[model samples]
Target: MENEKETPEERRERLRQEEWKGNPTGNLKDSTHRSSYGSLVDFVGGMGWKGTGMLIILIIVGFIIYFLFFS
Candidate 1:
């Protein structure tokens, strides 16, 4: 009865909300991604190529520092 009374736009929005409720990917910051390396990959992917390159440079620098001081 309520569905029949709803306008087309309202029905469409309701359907979209229902679909979103069933979708696991609706929340990018959910614990599932944060529980694994997926979060790190997502972070790097969100950054452009330049940022990724910078991250690599930082990692290499970190490794070099560790080797120089600890190893």
Candidate 2:
């Protein structure tokens, strides 16, 4: 068995099975609904204050630009 070679597709399938075992909940998108504020808090909590601040600033600037020119 040690001398036998695995095909590329077989190796890929084995790796995928191992990853699936580690994460039994493969459906990561099946999350509960959250309010906008709650979602924002969760995002900030997941990706530190600096990242969250930059995102907020960008969103504010985008809205301002939209109102000034697009609207």
Count of steric clashes across candidates, in order: 0, 0
Q: What are the RMSD figures for all models against the true structure?
A: 11.6, 12.0
Model 1 agreement with the true structure over 4-43: per-residue lDDT tens digits: 8997656765776787678758644455556655566457
**Cα error of candidate 2 at position 46, Å:** 1.2
Q: Write the per-residue lDDT of candidate 2 for residues 1-71, one digit (tens) a residue.
A: 84258865456557767876787676243233353235554466566668878988999999999999988
Q: Model-by-model lDDT, in order?
A: 0.73, 0.65
Ten-residue region with minimum lDDT total, candidate 2? 27-36
Clashing residue pairs in candidate 2, if any?
none
In candidate 1, the residue pairs with backbone N, CA or C atoms under 3 Å apart (3 or more residues apart, or in different chains) clash, namely: none
The best candidate in terms of TM-score: 1
